[model samples]
Target chain A: MSEEIKEILEGLPFWEHLEKEERELLERESRKVFYPAGASVYSGARECLGEIFIQKGILRTYLLSDEGKEVSMYRLRQGDACVLTASCILPAITFDVEIEAQTDVEALLIPVGTLSKITKKNVYAENFVYKEAAKRFSDVVEALQQIMFLSLTQRVAAFLLDESAKNHSQLISVTHEELARQIGSAREAVSRILKQMAKKGYITLTRGEVKLENKEEMYKLLN
Target chain B: MSEEIKEILEGLPFWEHLEKEERELLERESRKVFYPAGASVYSGARECLGEIFIQKGILRTYLLSDEGKEVSMYRLRQGDACVLTASCILPAITFDVEIEAQTDVEALLIPVGTLSKITKKNVYAENFVYKEAAKRFSDVVEALQQIMFLSLTQRVAAFLLDESAKNHSQLISVTHEELARQIGSAREAVSRILKQMAKKGYITLTRGEVKLENKEEMYKLLN
Candidate 1:
């Protein structure tokens, strides 16, 4: 880890508590890899393999059923932890889904066994992992609640707003198909809704990018 | 707790490793209370409360949105722990949902403050709590995946199978309105599907009870 990326990792809730030495131990065990679009970083069961920190680019978590239906469970952005959310845990964690790079991606993959070794020897590491698990668990539950209760339009608006915040850019690169999978809707329906929102002046769409024209106006539709 | 219920609790992951005396402490703190059908045990925005162990009857967990729309999150049956699932360790947990008794009910409540104290002092207790949290987290995530990916009819069938297994009965006492909220659909739509399923001999429906006549056939539909 470079001084810059190490500083960022140190800011992360999970790694923040580790002593400089312990953090180095983690860094030593971790393998930094870059994957191009459509590559699988980890392809296996749903078992808790540990955690991965997204250093760059975008990843999508999806499940493919035996019949080949694709279900997009979540998308991973930079600074996100893969294992903390859903990767591999005991009691047989098989990913009915696969993790795919949406674009060129860089990530730090940590094995669960390595994490367990460190945590077992260090109280700080143990507490950090537990806390990280708790936080990620809450996020997954919140996402579940949102999907259950929020309307499709509300979901799209929220997703757009979140993406805008994350990138700090009004313009985000996404296709209708990807958006539909993220919000668990049909591609055609998402396209229609996006078109309608664009016509209403809340957003503008172009090839490979959508820009929010009026943030306040779009938020009002969240209700 | 009686010897019988104590045995049951001991079998649960949370109580499995506790010393007999330590287990007795939990038993002493627990008090059984009963509620009539249609009673609200806890409401939204309530503080992080104690855990509840269902001794008898069915309970529903649901959120009442700002627009007064009710979204059912999960159903709690006998032998389930409610407080463990509702803990607010960090990020300041808020009760987004209410717990309501769907039938005459009896449950044991364990205060969160006491559990916190126990966890701080007892390693076993802390481990038990963390493990329970992890398991519950997995359960909630699994449910979200189902909701996001599964077809409406598939979800309904799977829900019926789950309820049947929990209650150990073919007949489940759930109104169309309750089923609709659980599955995030309209009550009329749920009714239409149930009626159709009944006509096809998949289930038998009375005023408020539904019984699966053929579990195998229903499971096939869920796929």
Candidate 2:
């Protein structure tokens, strides 16, 4: 069990920098959690969830407004940890976002107290958390810029192009409603924009997928 | 000179957490910079500025669209540090926002290399950076929520109330153009909204300012 825990820790990018004692403490204290796809992993305020380190699959972190509008913040991929959970150092800071499993996820859950203790004593762990937080901050800023500055059509085109590239395929397996939620727009608006894109020969939309036809046009729209 | 540096360092909230050697290095290496009101402090891409610790006054960090529209991200006041400048930990992560002196500002600048070195070696320093980054991340997320989920009128009303409260005056000393820039809206649109509010006896708009008349109605609009 100890060796297995060590192996799991070693798989993380920053684990090699951890001290032996720190690794041992983490192995002994942290709990492993598994969530199937579409499962609501964590929600409510930041205090509810402890420090989460994704070992496999993906988590979608988002915010839902009082009026039921949802804005997708960012995705937590494998080896990504929730830096916001380490809020002990940040006073009354609150993370009012929800985390859901986008795919079957295997994650390590460390209690906030344990993580805070380690962060206080271990430079390597603190650096890892700091870097993760910084990266997430940049991501949030980029998402905000897209939502505020870009037109709905431009956003949809850019999303299609980026998703296609990310999946290494011209066909993106996503729905217009999903796209709307991702870009923080209405479903009808997203569907209308996508239909227009199809009319322009930029993309071909089916029931739940969109196939890219003119990558150049889509890139132009993105610009 | 060394005593003066120590005194300056001690003025910071995180100063006592730093080790003696870290404090000495910061005293020897960090440079103090001052910017008058409305001065462009940091702009362009992420490469220009290093880690910044604001000692006095206010710095407004904002994002500008291709069409020249601006959205205020957050403000860094006294004892606040720029977490974006700690991007040395995450390679290729860029912060594209522009920083301007909202008021006459005094700040401490540390080279990227020095910050990176100390962050890697000192847990206390890393904790300071992590907390700052986490706080900024929360701020960005909140800003994104406002941009994506709230109505423009609601945002404007909320902004007025918040600003009034912050200044301890019902009279907000700002132009409609400045308000539009802060909320990422057109100047004409903001002016129209303010006019409508004034017609409804919610506010009284002057040449370059607005005075709140009905706080209850403004709060109602915020809801």
Candidate 3:
């Protein structure tokens, strides 16, 4: 298990830069964890969960409302790290959020204690965590700007473009419900918007796929 | 000038916790900066402005759209410190945000070099920046959730409650335009909603003040 963990850690971007002592501490202390699809990974008001380094699958961070509405904040892909759960050492987190496994996830968690000690001792580790946390902060700011300042149509266009670019395919395979979940909207609302876009010949929506028919025009919509 | 700065530094929450060395470095390097209302303090694609510790007035952080729309992200008030401007050390900031002075602002600016040196040598200073940055992250997440998940009515109600509590008064002094700016809405929309709330007896809208008549009922609307 330790050997496997070592291999996994070595695959991470931050691992190579970690000093010898820091690497030793993590090799001794890091634990592999798993979450099935749709599992609630982190909820607010819990014990510190330290930092998570994803080895497989997607981990989503979002906020839930009293009415059961979920607004997606950002996602962690394989090789990504999240410092949000390490709230024990970060007392400035004043709000609660829900994190879930969008797909079955395998991750290595550095416990708060170990992570704390390493950050205290290593400036690079501290900078790494601070940078990771700031990335999420930037994502949240962008999401807020989109929702509050832009139209839902623009958001839909940007989402489709983002998906297409991310997957490196003109034909994006995603259901209306899934897109709605990612964009924080009603499924019906997303479908209606897509249908209108399809009518306008910007995209072709067939079943669960959105094929970009006018990619340039769609890209122009974002700017 | 040095004595006045020392007096001002003694008033901050983080100043007391800073060690003698950290305090000396800051006192020697920090400078008082002022901005008039409507001044743009930080924009993306610039040199690191270091972190600003507010001495007086309000500094607003927001995102601007090409269509001239402005969405407020968060605000920093008196006695607060912001680590976000020190992007020289935080390369993980991937998005650009505009920071403006909402009021004629006076603040203590810690140059990026001094901040970098202090955090590298002082664990407490590092943690202090981490905590302050996390507070802004938490605020951004909350703002995103509010914009994407909740209704405008609930947001207006909650805003009134927050202002009332912040000012420790039943009556809140703010214009519709100012309220719209804070809530990331339009003046017409805010006025329309305020009129409806006034008609419902939840609030009384004077020219520049919102008197919370049924404060309990307004508070319950948030949940």
Interface RMSD of each: 3.8, 2.4, 2.6
Instruction: State the TM-score for model 3.
Output: 0.85
Clashing pairs in 2: none
Off by over 4 Å in 2: A2-5, A11-21, A85-93, A111-113, B1-5, B13-22, B29-31, B85-93, B111-117
Worst 10 residues of 1 chain B by lDDT: B86-95
Q: What digit string (tens of lDDT, one per residue) describes model 2 on residues A1-223?
A: 4464566667665577778887777878888889999898876654455678788887887888888788988888876787655555545356667778887998888777777777677666766666676677777887888887888888898788878876689998788888888878889998999899899998898989899999998888877
For lDDT, candidate 1 versus 3, the one ahead is 3
Candidate 1 lDDT over residue span A28-60, tens digit each: 776666789978765555455566778899888
Instruction: Considering the true interface contacts (CA pairs under 8 Å between chains A and B), give the fraction that model 2 also has.
Output: 0.66
DockQ of each: 0.33, 0.59, 0.56
Candidate order, DockQ descending:
2, 3, 1
By DockQ, who's the top model here?
Answer: 2
Clashes of each: 11, 0, 0
Q: Write the per-residue lDDT of candidate 3 for residues A1-223, one digit (tens) a residue.
A: 5777888767655676678888888888899999999898888766678899898988888888777788888888888887877866656667777789988999999899998998777655765677678778878877777776667888999998887886689998789998898878889998999999999899998888899999899878877
| Candidate 2 chain B least-lDDT 10 residues | B85-94
Give lDDT for model 3: 0.81
Candidate 3's clash total is 0
* Docking quality (DockQ) of candidate 1: 0.33
* Tens digit of per-residue lDDT, candidate 3, span B58-143: 88887877777878778888888877788667656666777899889998888899989877776557656766777788788777
Candidate 2, residues B71-159, lDDT tens digits: the string is 89877886678866555464535667788898899878877777787767766676676667667777777777777778889889988
